[model samples]
Target: MSEKATLKRSLGLWAIVALGLGYMTPTVVFDTFGIVAKQTNGVVPLAYIVALVVMLFTAISYGKMVRVFPSAGSAYTYTRETMGANAGFLVGWASLLDYLLLPLVNALIIRLYMESLFPEIPAWIWVVLYVAVVTFINVWSMGSTSGLNSLLVIFTVLLVVTFIVLASVQLYQGMGAGTLFTLNPIAHENVQAVAVLTGATIVCFSFIGFDAITMYTEEAANPNTVPRAIFLTVLIGGGIFFIAAYYTQALFPDLGVFHLLDDTLPEIGLYVGGKAFQLIFLAGAFAATVASGLASHASVSRLLYVMGRNGVLPRKAFGYVHPKFRTPAFNVIFVGAVSLLAIGPSLELISAVINFGALIAFTFVNLSVIAYFAFQQKRYKRPVDIFSYIIMPSIGAGFTGVLWYFLHADAFIGGIVWVSIGISYMLFLTKFFRTKMVDLDFDEADRPIGKEA
Candidate 1:
């Protein structure tokens, strides 16, 4: 028989890391700084620190899981292989909220940016244009997506460095904190543990892209490369967030300076640079949005493709990879169709909704490690294994659980509704648990390069 078409494996460590960074959208730190600063009482950097520590544990757990079960399904694949098909299906279903809505959020953000720049234009026009371009690029090939994403990421990084330099110059000239090296940015008299923790919960969303690296395992040059990419994506992305937050908080240690606390990037650009620089800042922001849109759009399509291949979703549409392009062309187009909804929903509403899936996926991935290693493999007898398999993931799970407590009520409402749909559909597929889900083949062809399946 002729072989089945598979995902082309062409991504190196740097290429994969670039996609992760693009997915994280490092420029998001500035967009969110003012809100988090207000929440933490001027300690935005400290809040990010807390978020980073929490994300690091989860990143490690993700790396551990990807090492054993290197596949494109990400949390869905890990949870399914370790837990059960039913559980995996549900996890993948929940993650659909996060993976799916993220691209929409990016499109929404672009609409807002365009409306700000050209109020005469209809917002829907911008949304359609942005989604069309991203969809086309993704459907073209993974290589094109990776190359474009890398360039955009590099541009954004340079912009970040420029902002830091300007902020430092202003700080030294006796601005907000009068100098860069001070605990004032990290702490002050009114600093409260609860407040910082609350801010941490909010900023935790900024680290969402790190876990996404696993979605590329099937495409990595070395499946083993995925683990390093996952950890480095988190470390490098977190470092950018921390350093940028430090300078920004030091420049304006209080919320009084920002007219729009919800989104301080514009005011930050105006204050630190000028009208000319504000345009540059907005351009950087646009690049970040486009980068994020491309990455998230690609990710959700692959997740859908994997589920489709396993019969959880429709086989013909979701599972089909184009023979010429070697891309999940149908799923990409489907996601583009969904991105049209960006015109209707407000960014805040969709943002909250995505968090529900992201945290759920993270929490379960941690549990999957314990399930697969400690129980399935009985690797907890050794002290090292106990620490790696038991203690660390437990901490990761606990941290995400705390964040769950702080999730918006709107998220609960939206998430519960989505989960209900997944349950109904899943029941129909399984005929009310009377039969097993069609087992997906992870044959020799899908394993990391240089490894036997």
Candidate 2:
């Protein structure tokens, strides 16, 4: 295919926000609520609040990078331009676990959720259905993907609103606690510092989708739209998460009563709104899963396209866009194929690899910001510039570093192994930095990261 077949720019602010939310999946709050509730000893909201704070710095760092290099490569592009090809390659490699496995996770959860809803149906049938639907939409066009994502997001948001209202009514009518507001979800008497921090680490997964908004910079109507979209993505997602956690926690004060930790939210759905509510909740959650898979599918394809076009990966496979739809067809289909692995792995194992890769990529994003300003070029601004470029990223890196340290040992091991593989591939490509590779011209790549090409 010719270079003219590259991704076409058409996304506006709201569309970008929808895509971000789709990737983040506001409904993740339900799927993870039980574990977070257990880990924090009933302080799920506080854990989410803490996670929101830590992720804000990472979001800010991502926004800053878009200004420097508003290209489709995301962390890979930013790291490569500011840090160098070698370091950028590793960032790209680590990020692969994140961009790819996430869709697989999203797809698998829908299957698990569906299998639970309708036990007669085979799980693999649901899994294949989700992957097929997501891949077809992504291969169509960003406009179609964004539009469908927006509608799905609206359904989820409305479901959340309905849950809050129903839960509130139940509370007022002598439900658990018999009150709408309480500090228990924020600071329970039995709260442990270690437990709260651990819960925060898991809650951190909910925040992953927001930074992905920047992946569409090349397709955004205005490059500036990318950063503000990132801000809104995080802020809006945080609002939904906090409200859901607060109400659900308030409704179920005693986490110890639940026989199975994973079934907490589904059971709570019955308490707050009965079988009808449970059905709606499951429907909303399923929609969010499909939408998130679509968003993740697109993101991984773009990252692969950037790598492929740059000669970072095999250009023949990853570099081309479809002539008609102007999408990264090969990569989209490739990721869809990879998502089939969802049928076998334990959710815990997949989650471990995803989180580890996300933290590594987030850590580099923070470092990339510092490097961009301190070593590459520091744009002069009154005061916000210094804080934006240095102080904030430092805090983000610090928080991410702590979480990464406390991450499950399995995650650390998997991440290290993944990186080791990347190192071997990098050596083969560069001949140990004794060779120079030609990058696809910035103009042809989509958007320029720097002020000039």
Candidate 3:
């Protein structure tokens, strides 16, 4: 519990990428496919394509910002450095809804999986055990957490590949669509603009974790590894989502194929690969939750550590790292404790508000690029500079802004309430806006590995 301790720099590019994929939870494509297909009128792949494009733009902005401010704080650091302390603190606060609750979301999903399989066991038992294991692994060491996460991600990816192969064979043998190549999955005569946009907003949830890669900047083997990892994570993860959505949408051209429209993974598994494969597939889904839980749990703890070290939160509690483990032990355990709330809320209710904070953070990161490069550095004088610093980030901002417009009203309300709380806390912390906020020592935080005392 030493304030002098810092996160160990033990992650390479592949380790960081695996963490990102785990956080994204590739199997989520199946769980959400039925709902998005229904919402998009069977054009789930098209919605995913739109979401991938939108996220790619934001990913580019994230890469650019990380090069300038390569700290574990991620969007919070970028926004604060370029924009101001107040905006950065608020963005970080709003981001807690997305970051903090994600571990609980994973816990909630695992409980659903367990209760479905073992109907006799109490649900809270699974949540407690799952949270405890994830928290302990993260608290133990970053290396072990990454190793376990990598294995889980690899397993889930293999299962997804198997499902696609089975679905392809079924389609070739005169199944739902009877062929692999078709425009129906992307568009048809009945597709509406509003519906696709709404579906895009929903599918954007699958793309959320790509940015979480930025949280490992301080732990990366090289400063440059982070940007490359961010782009790779988004493109690779997006490709998986797109391909899965296409094949799954083709296999079941209509919602009528699924008995449970909102939750179709089990039914899809039962249909595509039958009972034995369904058993294996369900196991993969559970693996995905564990992988995701570890990644999200670690990511939020780092974010909390950065904020705590900066005195935005309490310096002693949130900022302390275990001297031997070199992990933010207090923040990790604190997040695990809060994750116990997973027992009360339904997944649908939590899912509703998750996107609110993500879009807010996404929108600000995009704008932060323009604010820092174009306005602050005057980088817009040249054509290439204009494209990189101005036009690109503008498009990224506009795209996320559109998603914000299409966001559920419930998300808007929840986000506003959270922001109001953050505002009140900020007012009290700053003594009614009279005092200057405490600043982080970037030189000490990002010093080269050999330079650290």
Backbone N/Cα/C clashes per model? 0, 2, 0
Give residue 307's error in model 1 in angstroms: 3.3
Question: Candidate 1 residues 1-453, lDDT tens each?
Answer: 555556688999999999889889988888778778877899999989988988889899999987887654377778889999889888878888888888888888788777666779888999989999999998896544688878888998999999999998999999888987999988789999888877787787788888767767788888988888988999999999999999999998767877656557777888898889889999999888876787678767776776677677788998788877878899999999999899987554676688788888889989999999999999988999999999999999999888777776788899999999998988888799887765643222242221222
Q: What do the candidate models score in CA lDDT, each in turn?
A: 0.82, 0.78, 0.83
Task: Give the per-residue lDDT digits (tens) of candidate 2, residues 376-395.
Answer: 77643647877877788999
Best-performing candidate as measured by TM-score: 3
Off by over 4 Å in 2: 1-11, 120-122, 132-145, 256-260, 263-265, 315-333, 378-385, 437-453
Q: Residue 44 in candidate 3 has what lDDT?
A: 93
Better of 1 and 3 by lDDT: 3
Candidate order, lDDT descending: 3, 1, 2
Candidates 1 and 2 compared: the better one by lDDT is 1
Quick one: best lDDT, which candidate?
A: 3
TM-score of 3: 0.89
